[model samples]
Target: MDNILMKNEKFLEKQRTYTYTGYNLTIHPHKTPEVYIDFFEFILKEKFFLSTGFRTYHLALHDLNYLDVNNKLTGLYGSLVRYENLLPSQFIDLNTGKTPEDLKLNIASNIKYKPTFFHFIFFPENHKIIFELENERSTISYNVVLQFFKKILDSDKFKVKFTSGEVHTLTSFKRVNSILKNKKLKHIEFLVSRPNPDIFGDLVDETISEYLEDQKAKNMTLTLTAQDGKYLDLNDNTEKLGVAAAENGEVKAVIENSNNRTEEISTKKFPLNHPQIFGKSVTIRNRLLMAAEKLLPKNKISR
Candidate 1:
């Protein structure tokens, strides 16, 4: 009995490590109210609980626990539950050593399901979320997360529109810098849409702003490239470039190194917000709070 217990403990220890990815979510209310209702308050008042079904699985949020930072409410730790029904065809009779025949089987008798849990944390203050790729089984994909949120919000009568971007860090930038070191900038492109005023304040040029207003254009694209092997030193505007690349637009640049090797670099290549790993030693609530500590701005962390 002791030997069996020891093997089970070893197996669980090996399965503890998990990777979590982060994303920023901006929520919009249905109407332009004088004061926007904070998400945390809204959830509390509404007693929000997501329960919905998709093609193959039913998804729901379960075992939710809220966290407070410095006496202020901030985020929550929860488990996403996915339930998939088992089909009769998946079963094989031991005596026959063959698959179960559909005609001979009763569909209602085969009403077995498997439930999976993917633990996650969300900080409403910054709208940052960290999702565990897996607990011990399959991964909850990015597309699934997006769709799940959209459906839940829609059911609650909240606006479902959201802008999502992968967080990148300076480490990702260092890799790009190494690849294009001493390279000549050959081409650059920027695609901008209805920029969020709160985040893109004063970043848009006067001329471009005027053009957008006058033309009432939904979006605009700008391109610049060096001619005759000339170097375009656009690095001087890194501040504006970073904002444009991250929030307002997608930025891409092509460069040619001295060895005649050309490579394409984009703002997307920068790894700003990297994934984090957690072992079983960390509790679900602490895992969520720790992720918030790392991603949330210092000033916002407390408040």
Candidate 2:
């Protein structure tokens, strides 16, 4: 694999320089012991989970701007590849009416490896990749999985192209200091869910603060919204938390936290709607949308 990768270094370098308008890549199965380069592409493109199928898997491609709310590109700047497995239960003995424990043992004995969730984020413009794994078994290393996809790219099987004639590469996170000369103010709001919003809000605020400080992003402002609808403004202390009417006519709490007391803050009724909240985590998605909104021009609104 290393030799194959080294042989394609020049080709990979050339491919990385070009901004891709779109991409088409092949995916190999996780259970396969050997890399089956000739596998049908349709198998890789199928949904991760199926009701009647013996195998379950998911495959999707998302825009960078959509995944990373802070990104300001309309073109395809990055891609996220997520793959997970659904348990194999077809081998279970249904006719014999085995007990749950028996079935469990049977399934365990039949299974060769533990299932894992693999997430790969590729920033083609910067030639950067972020890989994450969840519930991974000790039997498999992340590099082994990564190598499978890397091999596909190294083989020149995965192809990409730039849509625009003029190409500009954004500052890569790996080399932020050399590329990012201009300092831009970023306002980010985080909404915490119920079951002790105050504590969670504080933790989120501290996390954002530490992140900004570590990244040397001094121009950013962090805001926290609790489950009760009250917001804590980390920037200007004068702002107060207020009550606002949501689109559904329900009352929602708005910003204002000062000196660890809520009484000193003033209240107001404002109707605001944000349509870009996404992701599985409510807290994270709201934060991303709020951060993106803050980066927008003052005159522009999400609603």
Estimate TM-scores for all models: 0.58, 0.22
lDDT of 2 by residue, 175-201 (tens): 221111112212223221111111123
Task: Flag regions of model 1 displaced more than 4 Å.
Answer: 1-15, 28-60, 69-73, 85-112, 136-138, 147-183, 193-219, 235-238, 247-249, 257-259, 265-279, 295-303
Q: In order, what lDDT does every prediction score? A: 0.53, 0.27
Model 1 residue 199 distance off true place after TM-score fit, in angstroms:
3.9
For candidate 1, the TM-score is 0.58
- Residue range 129-201, candidate 1, lDDT tens digits: 6777555577666556656665545552444322221222112333334423334778777765444233323
Q: What C-alpha root-mean-square deviation, in Å, does candidate 2 show against the real structure?
A: 21.0
lDDT of 1: 0.53
Off by over 4 Å in 2: 1-89, 97-122, 134-141, 154-303
